[model samples]
Target chain A: MNPRTSMMQGNIAVAEGAIAAGCRFFAGYPITPSTEIAEHLARSLPLLGGRFMQMEDEIAAMGAVIGASLGGMKSMTATSGPGFSLKQENIGYASITETPVVIVNVMRGGPSTGIPTLPSQGDVMQARWGTHGDHPIIVLTPAGVREAFDMTVQAFNFSERFRVPVILLLDEIIGHVHEKVTLPDPEDLVVIDRKKPTVPPEEYLPFEIDETMVPAMANFGEGYRYHVTGLVHDQTGFPTMDEVKIEMMLNRLHGKLDKYADEIIQVEETGTEDAEIGIICYGSSARSARQAMRELRDEGIPVGMLRIKTMWPFPTDRIRAFADRVSHLVVPELNLGQIAHEVEHASCDRAEVVRVNRITGDPIHPEEIVQKIKECR
Target chain B: MDYQKYLRNENFPHIWCSGCGAGIALKAILRAIDDLGIEQDDVAMVSGIGCSSRTTGYVDFNTIHTTHGRPLTFATGLKMARPDMTVLVVTGDGDATAIGGNHLIHAARRNIDMTVILYNNNIYGMTGGQASPTTPLGDIGTTAPFGAVENTFDISGLVIAAGAAYVARCTAFHAKLLDDLIRKGIEKKGFSLIEVMAPCPTAYGKLNKKGSGAKMILDQKDAAVRIAKAEKMTAEELEEKIVIGVLVDRDIPEYIQSCDAAVAQAMNARNGSA
Candidate 1:
């Protein structure tokens, strides 16, 4: 039998996708553009024997998500701009503790509540570095409604598998947009659970890792009775003042993602095999970039596009290889060249990076990108 | 009591200083848990960043030493996720009343099933001698070289007004009473707040000429008035007295049970519609 298709909003699709991914707990504070995700879960989760809590604030919500994750539940929280800022401290705690959680940050105008009701891709860098620390995080951005559902599932899977906090970065446009999404059957979709310790409780070291670089997680009440702390800890899960252990732990945290970048990093390239000019963008702006790419190609201009799905653990190698094939690459986003700077760094002088920027809480139009592409030509 | 059974021996030489009342409070908690026979794996202790927050490091339970001022929030999540597990929060005065005040009130308001053991040392012990929210007016702290000008918070009253199901106040001097209150708090199936008036001799004591840690603990004994006697005293008569005992205890709907009921109702509504 064919899967049932339904008309759904982007945030609703994300909430449904979380339920499909076996997320049993959601703790969130209501925020503009992202509040719908919480509202949807509030009504649906309890009916399915899942827990939904509207925490007092964003920080509390983030804390609750990490707490639930440590208790052996697939947990998540959603927020927008200012709320995201409030959650950074606990987000850092989740990072240092190697807790598996999914945070949905719906992009909005920022630099302190700039615009609440409109669209802007201003949190790209913040999602990458918002939490102050040299820690590992996986971030995924989805352009449309269906991708939003798919990426939410992928976010949970990656978080559980890597035992790292995963971020689903969405923009106001996609969050509010309504579209037809045919969700996959629960059986067909890939669902991953964090690896549990095989050793007896007495011998288990909470932070010990093998070649995978990701340690097996033990639930709070699972008789592990282990300790978890935000302070730099050794394999025994106890804080250590030894410099060598601190350095080793930090490296392991970063190396876990670096070694598995091939599995974590994802990018979609269209018409980029033989092109003179390329466009690189993500989230909502990628929609306009794709339109411009198709229009330019149809007009007989050698143009292609690289759409970023995984924003962190950035596809640097792929961007460099693409730049080697193209003379110019246009990086257009809703912010002031956040990703453009990253593209310039990644392209490594192989391509002259041109930036088409927008910061008025409005979607970047295809005409705007087409005009920029023509200027580059 | 077999203190070693509940203690993580490797983390010994704890950060608490000599005469630090937090050690006494920790002992009371361990004794309470031991008396109640809560399994090591069944209890989860969470603490914020402070000298008192160090309690989790020495405990053998499933413990987490979380960020500054946020142990209650984390405990709320852990409790909601695993309702079967007993959750306890250990926080300092500054950690709970200053930075984490919002969480403290909200947790009480939600009436979640958890026990909060608040160590009110009246000053920030770990970060030098800074005046905390519980620091009394005119008490000298490093931040208040002359004297603390700000009025202090009545923590137990705050939790009571915020709708906690159980609220108690005890002092490190009242070690036996502290253990009994904690045992009752753990047995209470809703949000329980037990504010322990722990002394900070190195910080608040030395700055204010409160003599030694033992002397400061003895002062708690003189200042405390049992709840029954204090009820009949006038405001002026009770001004210097720290009313110590169970201040609030009543039956209320616990958060997790309400959540389960809401879920059942929702499922029933859906089934009816189908």
Candidate 2:
């Protein structure tokens, strides 16, 4: 069976999908679980006239992608929890400056390099709050290998299309899992390119606002030159301290993500049409939730699984939609109730939801998730 | 001629005082970038938040004004992604040594192929001149109103100890020499840390009786030692002065060179195995 309609591990498909989407620059520092991504990119990037650099450390590795993206390349860097922690500052800058880049966070046991070789989804909150400030962010989580590939491509597409940093949140299980990946000729893929300014170089403000909210980005040599700062700035991209300007810039930073919520937020629901219990989870937990939901439905418990594709600027509306119908919702994650908070916030006192939290550097068992769903039932 | 064209003219005069070392350092960086014949596009200048970090707007390039003292971090991603491009990291004494000091050592330890021009004014240029990591003991600044009690850090010595492949010291007194060192730092293959000894006459200089900018330059020039004499000088004789010029240059494994080699070997083995 081909990838057209066959099962594939999420990580393999992500690697394949990234290649399919024309990602040419891959720089990473090795960490467990995510190491395969570096290995795969190292092997594949060179074959497609691209480059991969195993940086001295994760910090430099992430920095390399930031520089490469500005160099007019679709650059990506992968790391697990500790490495992701190191990349947070740059990721924040990427958000503030609207730099188009992709970061694949194959989260593992963390807080301080907890477990390098095991699977854990403990970075759910760090993915959104690790970096400082109130800048806008976009995160995409893949439930499986197909999404690993499709999401990597989507992460790149979203980064370019929106001119923001897009994160592909994968867990160690999804990152290291081996499966057959479907790859097609690159020419056939819908490669999303950044919106370059058609305005003349002199007239082009690098971060000048237009109708899209995201400014028209210009290549380095193309001459529409302006400054980009991590500080809150106005339409010109210069650092501004004016209170009004700060508010406007902050609003724009948030608006670019929140205003276009319908276009940006993504999710998949199974058996939700008549389900009494809703299972909410993401990353590798989404996989467990799906399996558990399957087992529960077979037992005729009337349960559904909501797999969140977009993690940050989350599938809030979807959770709200589910709130109108489901009597109870359950969130099982490797961390202490991160997405559960989002679910609770989105549920808005409509549905009774609780968290199943774990931090043992192990995956949530499908049976455990199903049991949680049943308990809610 | 059009310094304004190469600069964000609107943010002119900068946040620097009448005689700030970071501003001069910024000029040297731009001159070096222009001297190398690197296109504005082919070069990127990154800075963390500080008076020196503010230099990102002073030079025209694909610039990123990054968070505090993490310019090296951002530059790392930029250079790794586009190895073909020249990446420069401009930071100040406190930013590189205090807050972002971890990155400074790691970058040096890795000997990554990027030029880090550290503007060492011996005082935090922003937040009203605080005591920096490099602030000599007993030197008074805004924060050290009762005199800096910490031992001064020798930047060149620190970089060498941190495993930087290219380590050099230059002062604002030696602008031409410092500029040349900055250029050489850029041309280097491994991690190059050119610690520029700059003056903050309005802040540290004024309080420490370091004299006006001209006098400060003259003082530095008087005390400056060449590498030959610097090596010859007895430890006791060099207590109060600095030995300027290229202090350290040795071959080390550059980040990309090692990575490229590993990638080649892995691919060859895979092919051979297949």
Candidate 3:
């Protein structure tokens, strides 16, 4: 029989996607536009033989997810802007310790609790640099309800494969929108389980990096006892102040993503084969850009759209290549020039980068993006 | 018993001061785990930032030394994920009650199965000396230069009120009793808190003129009253006394067990509907 189709809300779709991805543990404190995700998970996870817990606060939620991940479960937590801000410290810890967990941040207007119920992509840069220090992060932004489902599953896969925290950046628009989704079969989806240590318990070192720079993980009760901490550490996972070891560890952390950028970074392009103008967008703004590109193509203007699915590690090489082909790039985002700045830096003075920015608690309309594309032309 | 077998010998001599009670507390915990014959791989020792939080680093087990004031939260997650493993949280007074106070109460309320060994030195021993939530009202510290004007917290009473299945208080001076209680706490199937009123000679002692480390530990032994004896005494009569013993020990549904039951029930319901 064919797969079942149902009308699902974005938040619910994300929850279903997580269940499909084999996420057996979820801990989160509710926040607006993201609360539905938690509610749905709370109801659905148990039915699927999973655990969902409401923690005391956002910090505890993040901490719990990390602990669960270390205990050999695919874990996740959902939050909005304020809660995401509260989670930065533990997020940093997850980064340094190489814990495989997923964080779902449904974006809203915010420096502090700004427009909790409204749609805005204001957390684009915060998703990249909210946590302190030099660390690598994988952030995927989904443009629609279907993409939300697909990317949530991908988030878990990437986190498990790389042994790093993955952030699913969902704007309030995509999180709250309802759409018809055809759920995929679990057997058809590519699910990656964390690599367990092949060495004996006495020989296992938690932070021992193999050729891939990603260490195999052993769960707490799995006979491979080891230490995990936030401090800069050596292969034994003990805290060290040695400069050489610290440098080597830091490089390995960054190298895991840097060397694997080809597999990590993903972007979707349309009509860019022979185009003079290209529109750069992501999240909800990508929808507007796609609409505008279609209208421009119908009008016989060769304008293409490059929608970023993976926001961090920045997709610089692809943007630079696009810059070489297109004469001008018009970037539209909900925030005032966060990713636009990166686009300009990546273009390397090749393509003229013009930003169409918005901070109002509303989606960037296709007409506004069309006007920018025409201006770029 | 050879306690050295459980310790990460290369990581020590530890960062704790010469006369600090955290070492004594750590020794007692190791003894309890050893006495219980729990496997090293089946125990996960979690600690937050403080002098006491360093316990995870020195122990040869599955350990996690987490960020400040967050060990209980992490322990909750670990216990929930692997309910079969014995999870222990080692936190100091400031790490447990001051910054992580909210987590403490919530965890107790949920009655998650974990043993929390709160090393209460009555001051922030790691950061030199600063006033802590459990510090005496008239105690002196660097932060409380003259004297502390704030009231202290009865952490045992607090956790008992918050619905922990097992709550106990002991001191570094009472090593045997502390060890016994820790063993009991570990055996319990819900949240168990053993608040150890440990000494900080380098910090709280020097500032508050509480005598040398040996003398302070002696004072703690003298100041403590058995819970049964304290129950019969008047409030005014027990003013300067610390009540030491099991404050609450009873059976309750554990958090992870309850979650597992919920999962089973939901699955069963779904099956019935199908």
Candidate 4:
């Protein structure tokens, strides 16, 4: 067999990426812009001796992914806006129970199934705060088909390492766009598996932590015979209402991600050195921002672009430094200034922040971003 | 059977109130597992939110207490991924028939290889006497102060119609029968459902003027009749009685087997085309 560049859609790349990352289980419902992911996996996974199930709904999909993760398989699910909303509760369940899984939310216009075929980055904040409570989350946004493939593999790596659900946020345009790309060989990719317990079955505690605050997980039917619950629990994984135990549990759950922020956060920057204007964006908007910056730079304007790959664990410190150096920041998003507020808060009044937002089921055009950069400069 | 060996002794005295039938159901489940000689490591005990769901915590297995009405879905995933292991689900009436009704019907329809033990106490015991989908008509609860007007569900019958391979109904009062039914359900290769009619002395009993736990259990013993005997009775004669025993038991192609076969065929077809 000879290798050649194959034309592939972003969603197909994601499914291939998951399979390369050793994802053995996928359960999801059909939703617009994300349905191709399920379709591809449904055809591909079974051939690789992996399981693919189209669950009854998005909630069940999330639940099944969590269960499959507990069964010692890397598992994933995909859906769109309304389905993403339905999955929040189980997402929270996975967070509290510390189950490793991946969720792909192909962004579409919404508040309730607004536009199925159109592109919008409206779920950025919902991806962070959609699930109730103060649990830790990791979300990644990809700007192109290749990044969708690369970041999906990264999402699984992060989920396995941190034992948290990693969200791969893709907009409708990126998800549906066809691009020619060389798929990476599986042998060259870095894959991480969850750490298993070293102790004997009689001595194992499912929630017992070491210095890392992450307990080694034992798969079901592995003789550990441990209990896992959504309730706040102690090192033993049983339900606990004790104030001290609850506080300790919450602190560890939040602290593990916070401690590894340096390893978890990824940001791509261009021309930020000695620039007068910095355009900060992610997802599909980042494509426009990059184009706008290139055009403005050609006109002898000091415009820079910072594209965020890891959306949550927000990269506040990097943004703060960029804010301090630049005179103004331009944030272009599909929604009405959702992540712009995060940029403003991270800037801490050091730079003037300009919000360029659109919600008309359309992608932000490079011209609009260029206009914002020129006006802000 | 040495049922105590299956329990997490330090986690006791359990949170169940005096005269609660959850303890009885738990004991029966443990006894059934012990009788069947199933290894603890091979059993994945799953449950949803409720008083009955808390049984996962006390049992020494690979237990998972999930969100309300969602254990079967989770169990389905686990079983699909690890078909060699036995997955069992424990749910309450409200957890199974109210919020999780869709999952129940679909799980049965798929005939997935898992056993579901639905603890039907007729009221939301943990939430303090609210009416559930299994609450009988004219039964009083906190949400049904003027007496419940809604009809109750026939859980076993519904699963039987939904294509479960094994379906049975037994009460907490009939401990041996319940144990035997659970064992039979667990041994089945496809979806098996055993609806355990437990009593909630603090909730259902108090609200419905059923005296104490003992009195309610006595009521169950009096009202219960074998399916064979009940078949001979007319609708009017059987109106007040509860049918107990296996309602359905049949040989069927299990879901996991079908899924594996389908995958094999698809792979073969892809290879052929390639």
Candidate 5:
């Protein structure tokens, strides 16, 4: 048999990339845009000696991924809007407890199952704040199928590196798009496993702060035992109402994330140094803006593009640098005004952030972004 | 046995009142797990938010404490991802029957391979003793100060209709029987729900004149009847009676098996082509 790379869609590549990333356990129920992921994993996991479970619902699917992660397996579950809401509580638990699990929420138009097949980037805010409480989250948005594959690997790696749940926010447009992509051979890929505590089982504190700010994990059946709860917890994973412990735990949680925020944040610039107008977008919206940038550049409009790879952890510094370089920044998203709200704050009166909003179960067309760019003049 | 090894080090000694039936239920569940010799790593003890939900933190075995009424969904996920492991969902009547009612029905209807142990204290214990979905009518819970006008839930019958492969009911009063039922539920292949009728001695017990710890167990004495007798009894005769025994046990198609088959078929095809 000859080994060669083949063209594959973004969702399929994510399943294959998960295989490369050593994700052997997958639990998901089929939902639009996310169904291909469930299908691909369902077909591939068994061959790789992994497990695949099509749960009865998305709620269980999310829970299973977290449970499997605890069982010494890299696991992920994929879903869209409504299913994302269902997984919020456990996602929060995974966030605080620092459970290394990957969740792929393919954004679709929705307050409640609004457009199952259509594409919209309405979940940007939900990805950040859907889970109750004040826990720091890691969310990555993939603009294309290739990013879906690459970012999924990064999601697993970040989850392992930081010991937190990593969200890969993809939209229905890219999730369903058919594209030719190259998947690296398994031998060429490096997978990230959860950092097991090297400390003696007796000395292990599941949530104790270390040099990396990530607490070491004591896998089930291992001798070092611990308790973990959703309540404000101490270093030992026990519930603590003490104001000091509360402050310490919350601070550690936030500090672990924002302290190295520079390392976790990712973005791409098309042309901002010598341009006066800017287009800031993510997910599929960025795809259209990339096309619009070329058209605008041809038309003699000095507009540039800044595509966010990491949506949460905001990349405020990168935004600031862009804000300093540009006169006007345009934010285009499927929501009425979410990411624009963040950009406005990060700009902090330095730059005027204009929103190109799209609430319908459709993406912001390139012409619409072009219109926004024309207005920037 | 080092039972304490299974409980979370932080939430030790439990928060149950002296005579609370949840403590008895917790002990029975731990014992059942021990008697079965399930490995600590091989059991993912899932629980929904409630007094019983706290059991996950207390017990070891890859515990997952989810939001209110969502343990079965979580357990179903865990079981699907790790079919070789035992996934047990520990939840209360209010958590499982009220907010999580839909998930329970669907989990049973599909017969996902997971064990759900319901601690039916009849009243919602965690949220200040409100009238739960299973609260007995005419009882006085915090939400029902003028006496409950709502009819109580018969979980076993509903579970039977929802197609749970194994369904059983037991009270914390009958420790041995309750433990046996839990063991049986654990051993079942598909979705098995064992509703343990626990007591809220501090909250619900005092109001119903359940007296003390020992007297509460005594009150459960006459409420239980054997399955053979119950099969012949009429509805009126069964009323005011809490039958304790295995209610439904049958082999059914498990969700995990079906998933495995798809994976297997795909692998076989790939191997043939290769």
Candidate 6:
């Protein structure tokens, strides 16, 4: 088992990664391109003494994940397109309550179930702002099956550490794409659990925080007998409408992620040191960007690639520097410039930002990106 | 019973208005929990958005005030993960029958071990007297100025059809009976739904000319008939009468236990193969 290697699909790898990360509960509703994740966990979790429930709908699935998280289990759920839309309310609940849970949105074309069986990175912005209100959330876009596995584990760790909901944003291609990879031994993996209250039940305050900005969470039925609510809450974890307390609560939620943005943001860069043309992408779209960059560089064109892993806390500084160094920056996503707009904002007039978008329910091929980069060059 | 033992005194002067039957229902629930002798630490009180959902904020258990119409889903997951704990849900007519109808039926179908205390206020009281699924036909609400044309939901009958192990209906007027029914619902090993027919004096009562909270409760007392007595009445006689008592109680394989058994079998097979 030390040299565990296998050909696996992206969704299967996520399930495997969840198992390895000690996620004891999974509640999900089946949606195309993401159904395999629920199916895999249904077969695997019970064997590991973990719980898997296929909820009535995506909203219920998200609610269940948050509940199980409160019950002291690392929990997750998966869905796509319209299902992701259905989950936004509960996702908002998890955000406000600061419950640790993981959500996997296997992106497919959609305003409403546009194309279920096809690939698209259309949900990138929705991952950030889908849940109503201003709240803190982490979104990770995995580019391949291996990264899906690695990032799923990272998602649980981040959610536990920050007590924030983490979204593993995968596209249809990534969900179904099969890749051969050697996964690390379980003994060698780094797993993180939510910080528990060190104080006695009488002294415990469920939402109190120090410099870490993340409160120690006491699981339900642990005798800490605390309150949890979606409403704006004070340190006591009860609802509050006092203006000062509301501002303080919102500030801590946003500030926690912002304070550690440097450590939380992850990206991989290649050939950007001397290249005049740079392509910035994530998820399966980044796969095409890498191929396009390699092809262009071989043709004596100065091209580079920056693939984003942590899509939220958005790596603004790194992307800004990359944009500044390059004369032209190309953002190739399945949606119409969701991240390209962010790149344009991050570029801050330092460079020309061009978007190569395709929403035809098909993956953007390397050639399309190559054509865009060549045009910019 | 000492109410202070379970009540979160800090959250006092609760959001429930004067004459709101939610307070009555909450007292009955605490009394039932007291009767069962379950520790406050082991009882998880969950609720959805509504006047009833605010019930969690008043209690000192492992309380969770979840999104609208979604407490049962959350409770289901919590119970599945922590089967050692007793999970209870407090929901409203609008929350349970309209927005969260699917979860209610499915939770019953799975026969999960949970006791649901549904407050049937007949109108969306929190939102100011809007018509809900349980608003009786011809009743007036903010949304139904003339008269409500939509058919009302028979909540107990719905859960019974959906396979609840225990189903009961009791009005806020019958405080002792409500307490007993809640205790019975909690004691049942599978899904239990105890619909508490509560009056919303400020909203539903005002709009429908249903008199003050006390007067409405008196109306409930007059309309209520014990199920044993109602059994002898014909359908026409039973119409417009509230049949108050445990409606269904049966033995069934509880969901969490069945899941645990399956997990054990799978582990055993794996060990045997290894």
Cα RMSD (angstroms) for every candidate in the order listed:
1.1, 3.4, 1.4, 1.3, 2.8, 1.3
Cα miss at B3, model 6 (Å)? 1.1
RMSD of 2: 3.4
Model 1: residues >4 Å from true position, as ranges?
A: A1-3, B272-274
Can you write out model 2's per-residue Cα lDDT over A46-109, one digit (the tens) per residue? 7666777776676667666776777678888888888898888778878888888888888878
Against the unseen true structure, what C-alpha lDDT does each candidate score?
A: 0.92, 0.79, 0.91, 0.91, 0.82, 0.92
Model 2: residues with Cα > 4 Å off, grouped in runs: A1-9, A110-118, A180-188, A366-377, B1-5, B30-42, B81-86, B105-114, B141-151, B160-167, B183-191, B206-211, B248-274
Better of 3 and 6 by TM-score: 6
Clashes of 2: 14
Candidate 5 lDDT, A238-300, residue by residue in tens:
778899989988888989988778889999998887788888999889988988988999998
lDDT of 2 at A86: 83
Per-prediction TM-score to the true structure, in the order listed: 0.99, 0.89, 0.98, 0.98, 0.92, 0.98
List each model's interface RMSD. 0.7, 2.8, 0.9, 0.7, 2.8, 0.8
True contacts kept of each: 0.80, 0.54, 0.80, 0.76, 0.37, 0.79
- The DockQ figures for the candidates are 0.87, 0.46, 0.82, 0.84, 0.43, 0.84
Better DockQ candidate (4, 5): 4
Say which docking band candidate 1 falls in: high
> Model 2, residue A306: displacement in angstroms?
2.3
Per-residue alpha-carbon lDDT of candidate 1 for residues A1-377, written as tens digits (9 for 90 to 100): 34569888999989988998999899999899899999999988877777899998999999999998999989999999999999999888989899999999998887798899889889988998998978799999999999999999999999999999999999999999999878887889999999999999999999995788999999999999999999999999999999999988999999999998999999999999988999998988999998898888889999989999999988898899999999899998999999999999999899999999989888899999999889987
In candidate 5, how many clashes are counted?
A: 2
Clashing pairs in 3: none
lDDT of 4 by residue, A1-377 (tens): 33836888999989989998899899999999999999999888887889999888888898898998899989999999999999999999999999999999999997797988999999999999999998899999999888899999999999999888899999998899899888777788898899898989888878776679888999998888889899989988988889998888888899999989999999998899868899899988998888898899899999877888899989899999999999898999999999889999999999999999999998899999888777775
Please give the range of 10 consecutive residues that has the lowest summed lDDT in model 5 chain B. B73-82
Better of 1 and 3 by TM-score: 1
Q: Write the per-residue lDDT of candidate 2 for residues B1-274, one digit (tens) a residue.
A: 3455467677776777766677777777777777777777677778887777788876767778877767887777666666777878888889888988778888898888889888888887677778999889999888889998888777778889999889888777777887788888889899998888888887778778888887887777788887878798899989778788888888888987887787778778989999
